[model samples]
Target chain A: MTTTGSLANGEADGTAGSAAPDKRGHRVTISDLARQLQISKASVSYALNGRAGVSDETRQRVLDLAEELGFHPNSAAVALSASRTRTIGIVIARDPTLISTEAFYMRTLVGIEQYLNEVDSSLLLRLTGENGEDLDVLRRWSRQGRVDGFVLFDEHQNDPRIPLLKELGVPCVVVSSNAPDDGVGRLISQPEETVTLLLDHLAELGHRDIAHVSGPFHFIHEQLRVQLLREHAAARGITVRHIEGNYRYDDGADHTRRLLTGPDRPTAVVLGNDLMAVAALRVTAELGIDVPGEVSILAWDDSPLCELAGPGITAVDQQTMERGRAAADLLLRLAGGQQQLHLEAPPGLLRIRTSSGPVI
Target chain B: MTTTGSLANGEADGTAGSAAPDKRGHRVTISDLARQLQISKASVSYALNGRAGVSDETRQRVLDLAEELGFHPNSAAVALSASRTRTIGIVIARDPTLISTEAFYMRTLVGIEQYLNEVDSSLLLRLTGENGEDLDVLRRWSRQGRVDGFVLFDEHQNDPRIPLLKELGVPCVVVSSNAPDDGVGRLISQPEETVTLLLDHLAELGHRDIAHVSGPFHFIHEQLRVQLLREHAAARGITVRHIEGNYRYDDGADHTRRLLTGPDRPTAVVLGNDLMAVAALRVTAELGIDVPGEVSILAWDDSPLCELAGPGITAVDQQTMERGRAAADLLLRLAGGQQQLHLEAPPGLLRIRTSSGPVI
Candidate 1:
């Protein structure tokens, strides 16, 4: 019953045999291998270290035994079966430009690095487009012994990569997941109840017609938000509309233009992210629509970009940095062989700004 | 003599009787190893592949020969000694938060990935503070056979890491380099003389007191820009000032406030980047100083944030993304064992918008 917490702390004591897995447990050791081989521990070390002092005859036997017994001399110098490369992988399955300024990865990466640096691990970052290309890359990497684990981001519900990761026997911690049972630990913002807070706030502002301009529809949270908005609109007996966008500036501008200019336009519009929200502002101004006067805009992710705009956008503060660090903490636990990880993140808070107001 | 380009293209012909070192050179191959050991190519392949059919005696001998001859089994599978992990490393030695909103890394990374993906290579990203922690991590990674090469960003004059990189024999492509024959390629904006263009533009605008707010001062381009501005200002018989500031929002806002509100405030200010320039605009607005009316502001790195600001930030477009791709192409060539690489980037284009105007 050695806990992951104890194991992480015991990292410093590995050299002095402080990492014994209790006296009775059958964890193999260097001395045990030497005793079984009838060779000196020094000779075993030389063979394992790829040193030339060991005879060719001895080195082959050592490698075979080590391989059979599942042992590798990792940085921590623990005699374990796990071939720990001490590298973490994160794949971006989108045009990186679309989400580069989100501050999600920045905060999350810092948190991941803070823990990994303490444990002395490196990050392997790959940015590629979706359509299962990332899975193929991960498969190749696993076979080639590239990374020890992954910190998955932007994973959607029923993501196909879950099955592939399980199949490959790769360990990972996914952030903001919405799966039935993917066997992946998730670090996410709190309950789905908060979606109503936004709708209710807008509804209270005397809005009859509402619209939601969204990020990529493939993401579960984005889909969930869209569905919830529709449900709330139906429940409140208010007219609502949904427009799909790619989370790019063009996507937001084009969608905002079409929605705001259309005859049946909503008084208030909610954008998927701050970047799009900013873009929406430009579009609104271009269309001669006044903020909080004619067209009210609400943005997701309370990034600085939202506040810095002409009319500070109303947004949901997701606590990006805290969540990022939390992701790393859970990932470390999962990597340490914890079966279940369900970290509850700081819930989203509705920051009412000048962007949203009573319907004109 | 066979070139690296031909070898890269000949990746499909690895197993055949192809990949022979042509004409007047000695490039060892699997055939050479087989001939030296008086064994068949099948035995060599089996031994090198770590298959069960090859006896332990034969495998050990093959490994010894392979190591001695500097041969590695890379992904593309030509029988030369480059221990191709097919992983490229890039170290971000700055505060990622300050510059995350800029699309520079996003664009550059895409370019880097486009080429590396073509050759089936991955990117290992390490973000660290400016205290040279990245080099230490890279040294460990190099010893661990982690990455085959690097794509270094923002390299400066007399950088301590240059000697270390050379010492470690790691292949790299440095952007904005100012070293004397560091044996690395550079992907810089074309027209190396754009600094004078900015100064000349400003000087002609009747601005006697000019100032520069920049990114990290340790970076070569920033230093070079500061120097060139001073030289140009001296030539034009105008006064110029240099104040160091991290390219962060707070830094921009705080520095601009102090400079503009000071006893001898400059009529015009040039910032290190768009984020700062945007911050400067807010500060000016808050301090009741009209931009381009009371104090003209010019920013570097013509990012979207610049154009989207209250007053579109006048900037010099360095074509960051294209330069990043060029860096990757040059790095690939250098990794192919080319002796020298000097790729000039497209020069910066001075784009004047609403931010900067004549001194009133």
Candidate 2:
């Protein structure tokens, strides 16, 4: 076996050796070189596998020569010794267009990429359409060692992905806590506490009627936040009503149009996501409802969209970037075999933006 | 060298060496089972390599064994044998957050995933910060055989990534036409043409003195589109001026304040992104600017952001998903040795929403 540094100059080097050892960064394996050189397969195999039948002179010359010329084993053998495949698999539940609109997901993904860059790992993505035939595709690629681990996005309340992911034996981390399995590691935003704090902020504004517009009911984090808002509002002798919608701006607009223009209108509204909140701001404007004078809106998931909204939506900042980084760190630890399975990182900041003013 | 059928069910019939093996998945290699069992490595090697030193009965038994048990070789062996990875590496300029928020990028990625899934190949993403570090990471990973080929995202004018990627000796599909090397597989969206079409739509509506709020100045697509808009307006005898800003909603608001309140303001405006168009709507609402009468706005990158924008933004639908799928197909073909490298897909409709109308 010849252990050598990768060639500084990009050059094809072919030598017969049982295996080629490469420098960590620039590996060009013997098999790759063999293919490049068009050498006999058996000769290259004998040379690399270190079978004793090969002449000593030829073997020594091959090893020494490969070292001098920078021949290394291919990525497959390298993968066996090192767990990293230099790729990360990500699973998203919604359309690509939806993911692009959510600033939180965008920024958090940026954070994950920052860490991945530090380690020289790549990110692989899969967006599952309805019925999740895509999941099966993921399963096959993962089994074939196409990626190192997975970054699971937009978890549902009772995710069907969990059991299958577990059975497959790939390392993964979830963005939301809706379907947090005890066996799997998680990075959860403090959804309940975030909602409580938002309620307190609204309650302090002297709002008597507060209504919540939450994301899809299937999403556990939305359920938890909405439930908390209801319970907390009741404790303060305030009545709260919740309407279900996807975590989308249009949904927010639709819900707001229904809620704001009707009798028994709430003085304040809370949204499950920032997109929805921005929509609510637009709806309120269209209906000529004075914000904070007649009604106030508080949004969840403090993405940049909240900051850009006209009234500057008052939002619950989950610090998605911090959460994404933590998830990456935990997954790295697991991949390295340095940590026990199943870790839980805490929620981050609850930055309140400007949308919700003192309710008149 | 015993090949006795060690089926989990313990049937142990002599059908172990049958060429027609169990169809559940791949047959597990003897080496994997031997490693699992912690038996002597030499013994397992002897049985698997088909060396003639062992007894005939034991050899047949060993041959009969693992097949009935249904254990398959790891993907590494298959990859080496077939010389095909069935996986493509994508080097993303930004991280996951960008994937979720930037409609163009997210839609493209999703489209890429859609095609790859159909072919049973997977995408491998390597995220690099805006800094130049991503090139080195991609180069190293490509050399190591981590991916069959690559898809380059966010190609900038005078982009350094192009040169570095070229040196890696793998086929690549770029989301840009201004690539350093035009011969490589390219997937470029016709943004410049889209801009001209937007202008035609506006000019036909009797709008003059149009203003533009563009994305970052250096991005090749943004730069080209801006230039196209300026040229098209001059050709059409319509007055034009532009303010540079990011493709962000807040940037829209900021530029709107500058353009609307300032002297010599254009009656119509075109935004580089849908988010900015949405922001412009909010700004108009705040300043009491009437749409289509006093001021009108158009946006680029038709997405849900446009539809959700109160007065839906009139935008050039870039067929982002189709772009992504085309890129995926190109990379797969190159990796599969078909070698049809360069491609430019057609642009789709410019969906007219509530925002765009004739100037009074």
Candidate 3:
């Protein structure tokens, strides 16, 4: 069950147990294989450990040689000295009761787990409360060399943990797109760019004024997109009104009711996420606002709920899986000793469904 | 940040070191504490590890003794003998790409993580794919001692992993309410029980016939509830019709188009989950069927989505957070060296929201 690496320059030739072959099996070593193949011990060990130094041709030759000699490395001995554990550590905020409501966090975790499983690594998750208890536990665990590395989620700018994690020399890749760097590696979505594209698309559709319903202000990504929305609107000379939401459908509904019925109501609306957008659709329907003809709506982050919503929701597709997979790959490299550097991918997709149309 | 433990013997009357410490600096050790408290090494180690041999009064005294002496056990050394890695491995079916769709999985994971954090333990996650690749990976992980125990989800009757897990000698708690006993622990929730109660309530209102739309047959809970629906109807001598669904809104819409528009439309309907139930409400509305007057509908496994679907869906409430927390607590006990046993808790709630009413 354990990944193995061959030993260098060690051999008790098969002849040692040849006399009692039926009971006491012969021990095949890397040296025995090297000798049989007329190759060096270094080449045999390199091939078995999956190290990159050996050429593909030489690697195959070494592998074939080992198979012919019936060699199997001692898994325990390899484990004791291997540089990597192929395991990642995750720390979460306390309040086990929050698991059901926080759907986004759960999705991200599942994505990370999927990526790790593909690479044959395991995840270690630690829960900490808001008061920094989890951080304390993680600090102790990291110093003891209990795990190879970590994947950081729920990152706040200038997080108290960053300094300590840096001191421990633990490699990490952050899930947050806007978390400030303190020399640690990170992976996050492109919120600022995504918002700009969304605003521009809505403006091009002959809409003069637009309303925005956004997520909680404390989150860095939420704040980044909010700031960008204001800047983009100003540059385009479009009037924009922003409302705060908790990234839930009800918040979207309540805000929609207030805005749609108000004097000088905007012709279109943009929501922070699909859940909120779906709420907007319902509230609009209740108020007798014909979508696109009277008021158009666009949502960020296209989830399956968008398609299932009655008329289908026009939304931003944030490439959640790519975001997750890229994070996993980056974390793996960092754990394998790749130094920290900024890595950026293309912007997420804009999935245009029936929710948004030209302003009449 | 390390969790400190006390020394065994009474304090030693020795002068403190006012000199240079080791390379990491700050020499905090059981040896130093034993000298300060004049205690035996065995006594200090016992108190530090939270072992049971010492009396409660004596344990408190030793703890205070260590605190006063400023003793901290070495983290690496302590980890060697502990039964719990302070880590739980979670196995799931979906890859990270499908994270957004698997909302229940995410919520439950968060709940588990939240509770484990309170106890200062960590969670290790592994996604076994829908096709059994995850099973192979999980088996290898369990065998290699990569995790202390497991939290299993999406139980099917006589699941293939059950036998493999049993042989691995790893303690596990299944999330399914109808989890079969194959020598593992169970956490059961009977969502179908709500159907019987709802049907009886509707029957009392003079409803002579009902229709049921259920999830896939492979799901044990869905199967049990659908079976119970047929049984309950037969016993009451009431006409009932059952249809299969993929747990999707479209499935509900498609089935609604088939049954509701036909001549055999019943006076009432019961859905497998809230997602499909909401769709049924929309479809029935489009077909001009009068709800509660001409037709009454009931749903299962209520969530926030129920409330957003115009008229709130009357659903059987499965306390998601409580169920998750209980499973976590049981896992922690197993990690703490408790003998294994099968456990079940009742699916004890039926939320009678507006989606169901007396038949006219």
Q: Looking at the true structure's interface, with contacts defined as alpha carbon pairs within 8 Å between chains A and B, what fraction does model 1 recover?
A: 0.36
- Using TM-score as the measure, the top candidate is 1
lDDT of each: 0.68, 0.63, 0.64
Higher-DockQ candidate of 2 and 3: 3
What would the per-residue lDDT of candidate 2 be over residues A1-360, giving only the tens digit for each residue? 111121111122221122334455434444344444454333343455454545666566555655665654332222222555656677665755566567766666666665555434556766555435546655765787766677776677557676677788877777667434456656555566665677678778888887888887777777677677777778887888878888777888999888888899888888888788888988888889888688888887776566655567787777666566556655654555433444344454456666677766
How many residue pairs clash in all the candidates, one count each?
Answer: 8, 34, 23
- B260-319, model 1: which lDDT tens digit per residue? 888899999889887788899999999999989999999887877777787888998776
Residues A94-180, candidate 3: write the lDDT tens digits.
344444553455555656665555345667776554555556666767876767767776566666667788888887777656535
Q: In order of the candidates, what TM-score does chain B achieve?
A: 0.73, 0.73, 0.73
lDDT of 1 by residue, A241-308 (tens): 87777777778888999898889888998888878898999998887899999989998777767777
Global fold similarity of model 2 (TM-score): 0.69
True lDDT of residue A250, candidate 1: 78
Candidate 2 docking classification: acceptable
- Cα distance off (Å), candidate 3, residue A343: 2.2
- In candidate 1, stretches whose alpha carbon ends up further than 4 angstroms from where it belongs are A1-83, A99-107, A130-132, A156-158, A188-193, A231-239, B1-83, B99-103, B130-132, B154-158, B184-192
Residue A49 displacement in candidate 3 (angstroms): 7.1
Tens digits of per-residue lDDT, candidate 3, B1-360, equal: 211111100011121111123345444554454445565433455666676555676667767865555443323224323654667778777534444563556556665665554344567777645545667666767876767778787667767767778888887877665745566766655546666786677677777788888877777777777777777877777887878877777788888778888897788777777767878888888888877667777776676566555566777766565566557756665555554444454454777777677766
> What is candidate 2's CA lDDT for residue B348?
52
